[model samples]
Structure formats: C-alpha cells, structure tokens
Target chain A: MAVFVDLNISHTVDKKRLQNIIETAAHLGYSTVAINHVVDLQQKKQEIGKPKCVSELFDQFPIVQGKSRPIKVLNRLTLVVSEASHFRPTNEFKSYDVVAVFPKTEKLFHAACMSFDVDIICIAVTEKQPFYFKRPPVNGAIDRGVFFEISYVPAIKDSTMRRYTISNSLSLMETCKGKNVIVSSGAEKPLELRGPYDIANLGLLFGLSEGDAKAAVSTNCRAVLLHGETRKTALGIIHTMKKIEPTAERREEEEAPVLKRARTEAV
Target chain B: MVRFKSRYLLCELCVSDQSSLQLLDDRAVFTGVRGAVCRAHGDYGAALCSVSFAVKYLNADTGVVFLRCRKSHYRILWSALPFITHLENRGQKVPCAFNCLYVGGTIRTCQKFLIRYNIQQLHRMLPHCHNEAERLEVRRAVLNCSLKSLEKEEEEDE
Candidate 1:
C-alpha cells in the first residue's frame, strides 16, 4: 500500500516542539516526513551547511498510528533562489535526502521547472503569486517528475494568509490541472499540522478533484522522493555492493549437478 | 405541506473549558461555520451554506449542536468544519473545535443517534471514575438517565 508522507516540516531550533510535531504527524498516520532546512539565497552573509542528522532527533522513532513500522524521517534542504546564480550544484546538497527550490521570480520559476536538479518546486503561499503559472513551465515540471509543493500552515494561522493560499493554489491548479502537486504542512508547531485526510479535503478549495487531492499526500510525494534518489546516482543507475558468498555457494551446487550428468553419460 | 429536503449535522463542541460552551448559541455557531467555509472553500461554498442553513437544535450543557443545510451542499459545510479553530464569543476567543458525530437526513434520526452516542460515552467514561464516590455518582446518573428516557418512551407510547 502507498503510505502517507508529509514532505515539509519547518526545521526549528526548539527540539521539544519539533518532536511534538513529528509525534503528532505519526499519530495522524504519516508514514514518512521530511524536516526542511530553508536557505534564502537573496540574503547576504548566509552560509549553506550540512543539515543535522534526522536519526539523532529521537532515541527511538515513533511508530505510525496504523502502520506497524516506525515513521521514516528525512532531511530536506529548500533553496530560495531569486537570481539564476543563487543555486549551484555541490556535494553539500547530496547530503540531504531531498532538495527543493523556491523561485522568487518568473524567470527563476521557469528555470527551476525546466532544468533545476531538485525534487520539489515550492509555491509561495504567504503572499500572492507574483507571476502567473504559465503552461510551458508547469507542464515541463510535471513531465520531468518535479512536484510543486504548497504549504498549508500559513492558511491555518491567519485568515488573510488563508486567502492568499487559496488564490495562489487555485492559479497553479489552473495551469497544472492538479498534476504533480503536493500539499504539505510547513508546520513549526504541532497544532498547525493537520491529518492527511483533512488536507485532501482542503485540496478541493485549491481546485483539485477528489482523487488528485488524495494522491497529493501519497503517490506524488513518493514520486518526489524517487526523483530525489536519482540525484545521488548517475542517471538513476545505482551500482550496489553484491555479496560474493551467495555466488560461491551457487557455483558449488552447479558443479555438483554437472559432475553427476557427466558420470551418468559415461555409465 | 411542502417537503423541503435537508441534511442535519450532529456535531459535538470539544473544549477544555466547559463553561465556554454557554456563550455559544445558534448565531455564534452559524457565523463560525460560515466564516470557516468561506476561508477554506471560498465564496462559492459560503453562498451554498447561506442558502438554507439553520441551527435546528443546540444543547449548550452537553455541547451538542444540530445544524441543518441543503442536502447537496452539506458536504461543502462538512469539509470546512475541521478548519474552525475557535469561536469568538463576547470579545473572548474560546479555544475549541467541532467534531461531527453524525450526518442524518432528518432531525429525528439525529436525535436518535445522539441519545445512543451519549449512552455509549457514559459507559466509556464509567471506568475512568477517580474514586468510589465518583463511581457511585456516575452509576446513579446513568440509571437516572435511562429511567428518564424510558419514561419518555412510555409517555409517547400512551
């Protein structure tokens, strides 16, 4: 079964609150979650560093509500790029499980959609989308398996932000027609996080059909995770270490069968 | 008599402070529900809710409310219920939420389900009684409520 995943949890300095948010997410049946470390490239004197290891957050990971397995926590880095040169491919990005880009301008958005080596392109929900979502970039992003993420935490906090969230998402939905869109909660606090079902229902307001809304929390997030995986390897071709012991055992068995056949032929 | 089809939502007001429920009337809930629907679902949903929305029954003591709306648009209102964080009453924001217990086609069905739900909640709470006195008090209250309900049924039968 495709498990539910919340791909964006705002990374906080407060350990207690972050634990609370993850615990709440587990209680609400999220099988996987990502702690997003955001770096705004527009700001000067900002340094990009390796994200904190997610395993160190808890001694024992909390179990998902209905699933028998513990919730999978992943580290993600969101680079907010205003200018074209803000994002540069480096070994530092490879340390994170997933990489996301927030484009501040239409040109950057087009670039991010077409050629950016990222898993998710975040749609700004705090303010109105400065540029309309054109057909070419959105379709290209969908074709390239890059998902658009719309965070719903701002909408839950303030009514004015809620309006912006709805309108911005509606416009994106108009161009993409709800494909490759993932609705995640950029929740710093536990209360801001809602259940997956509640968000799927909320997706109706964002102009997604019933089925696509459900997929936004499950299948689309999984696809983004897979897209992120390709970044670590050369064109999604992973060469894993093979166990030599199993091959030796199989060789011995094959030799024994061949010896028996030769003896039978000689007899 | 013209038969108007409607759907009734049986919702329970979940709050930390029980007294805050007293300030919640039909109008407060109406405004709260409408505002939430408007915020979550936009003007289209708000318009759908306003057409035939009414608070048919509200038990302030128990925090149970029965909301009636057109059958086709109850889903829009239902989907928006979870977005309501609090209800503003008398210049104070009451920290609460609405948990929809049941959705029925008529008020009678909702009333029947509410009685059944209350008895089930009573039975569930019986074991959590802190002391012997509280246990005995809960037992007495349960017996008295059952007896009162039985009497009402008998009166209706007669």
Candidate 2:
C-alpha cells in the first residue's frame, strides 16, 4: 500500500527532530508529505498594529523545490481559515499534488475550487480538547509538545471546525481523520497519533463510507502525492469558470425587508 | 441543532417536503460570518451565500451556530455545483483529465486527443478540463477581489 505521511514544516520546528520525522515517515515507505502550517497571523496583526495579512505567507514554498529532500510538500496552505486569505495559500501552491486546509475556508474553497490543480487533504482533529503548544517548531514561543491539554473554553463539537471548512475533499477527509482538523500535536515530543486505519475509522463513524473512509487515509493521500487520481467519482473544480444560475426572484422579495430592518438595528 | 435568525429577513425559497432544510419553509436564513452587521440591507443575495444553509432555531440558548461544510476539500465544490448540475441536466459530458469524458456514472471510451496516458506514472495526469473559460474566470476573480480588498484597506488607512 502506498502511504503519504502528513507532515507540517514550520520555521519554529526543531530542525534536527523534524528531519528525523521526515526520514522516519520516508523510511516507512510514504510517497509524499502533505505540508501545512497555521501560519499564525498573530504576528502580522502585531506588526501592522492592527489585524493585517501579508500576501507573502501565501507564496509557494521555495524550500520544498529541491528533490533531494525525501518529503515532497504537496499542500501549501496554512490551516487558518479566514474568508479572504484562506484560498490564497492553496492557489499559490496549487502546483503541488495535494492542498491542506481546515474548516474555515469552506465557502471560498467551494467558490474557488476549479482554480486549483490538486486534491484536498482535510486535517481531521483527533483530540477532543483545544490544545496549542507553542514550542520547538512554532517560532511564536519555540515551545513544543502538545501545548494545549485543557481549556477554559469548551472544546468545539466534533463537526464544528475552529475555522469554517472550505474544501471538503477526499484527501482532506483522510488526513484530518474526522472532527479535529489537525495533525500537529502542537508539541516537540514525538506523539504516536492514531495511524491511517485508526483515523479512517473515525471518519466512517462520522458518515463516510468504508471506501471514502479508507480513501481519506490511504488512496486519497497517495493520489495527492503521486500527482493525480483515477476513480471516476473523484471531483475537481475550476475557480473562475462557474456555471451561473438564475436566482429566485420571489425569495429575494420576501427576505428583502426583514434584512433591511435588521441592518438598521445593527448600525 | 436548529438556529434561526428571528428578526432578520430572507427571500423565501420554494421549499419542498424533501428539501435539505425543513424548519423555515420557503426561507433561507442569511448569516454573515464576517460580523459585518449592516451587510443585509445592501446585498441579500450575497448575504445568503453561505457554504451551507443555516436556519435559525428559536429554541437554542446560544446564538446561531453555523453548519460548516466539513467534508472533502471538494476543489471549488460549491462553485462547480451549479455547472455540474446544469451540464448533467443538459446531458453534456464533463471532461475528465484522463482524456475520456466522464458523466452519467461511466467514462466514455472516445478518447480526447489532448491528453496522453502514461501507464508508468499515473500521477502526472493532464488537465481534465477541455476549456479555459473557468481558468480565466478564476484568475480574474482573485485579482479583482484581492485588488478591491487592498484598495478598501488603503482607503481606511487614510
């Protein structure tokens, strides 16, 4: 079975340890690695002295280009899902075999599907609690090892993604496992995450069939790294070329006034 | 859980007994994730253009809980939906990257000449799309939207 290990390469990661994991995943016969990041805009916000997003983070990663590295970074987008910049990372990295994302980009991902050239590897969060370890990998703290364990804030429901999902593709369905859309333990310590089968079973319980469930772990990921897919059922989208449809004028009239009143109240 | 926007208004869509949503018959709840509160008055169509249909349920203690599309990262899955439906309804064959047209649950053997098959490397598949209209449209949308957004930011700074 051809397996693609899902890995995220961040500047803050311990360079030596990260290299070891990449080699470990590679030695295990993985075909490619789906690279993603949170690409925290917290710094961007701090820099601009207000909330601001730079276009550079979305730029295609140059480090992954040289083939000498055992891992090939298929997906480039960070995991954060804001409305505007969410799709930019995917678009910039569309040349890769797979794209990575969380729930936040759902609307834009769908709206801009066709513009991409890869399959989506949705990151399913396995742990229930919301934990973020700022450690060895993440520069924010050079901290690591399952940063979050407990939270004053409630853990988001299984289906509820921290950021709204954009593109719910076969690849993403497999990698993320299910409710928790992430792979990084947010730590420096090596965490023994539930392997592919374990992850796929979670998806099965959450409404995916055995085939789709398996694809989320095995084939969807392989297809992404191997650079294409075969099954006729698989889907792809062109971002701009949309088939426009006529609107229901009747519905428009009815919803019109209630919204208008609400707007007046909001302002 | 059902979440309803009681006071807000929406264009009432014709609802069938088997429609995806049942609570608000003929009504699609329009919610803005952006917290742009005044958005409703200016644009009703775009306001309701959410990833999934969310209706307000009067009974919830919390405010409206949106249904996020947490399925496969369907590349432009939302955008191509109308097109796919239209093409299928019209009995048009949507092109697949492997050269053969795919639709109606089977691949047409009539090979499209543009793509070549490499049995040794199935990963390097050619574009399934036979046309460029969608590509150009996406490029334009990104450039236009990004520009407009950038301009809006600049104006606010001044």
On a 0 to 100 scale, what is the lDDT of residue A264 in model 1?
49
lDDT of 2 by residue, A83-176 (tens): 5453343223433333343323444334333233323423334432132221221221111111101110011121233222212222333432
TM-score of each candidate? 0.72, 0.31
lDDT string, candidate 2, B44-151, tens digits: 423444434333221122111222221232112222111110011123322210000111111111111112222211222112234698656645764575446645
DockQ of each: 0.20, 0.01
Q: Candidate 1, clashing residue pairs? A: none
lDDT, candidate 1, residue B114?
80
Model 1, range A1-267, lDDT digits (tens) per residue?
Answer: 458899999999999889988987886679999999999988997777998888889987877755567889999999999999988978798788899999999999999999888999999999989999999999999898999999988887788898899899999999999999999999887656777776777788788999999999999999989888867654555422324787677666655555545534543
Q: What is the CA-based DockQ of model 2?
A: 0.01
Report every candidate's CA lDDT.
0.83, 0.30
Candidate 2 chain B superposition, TM-score: 0.16
* i-RMSD of all predictions: 4.1, 18.2
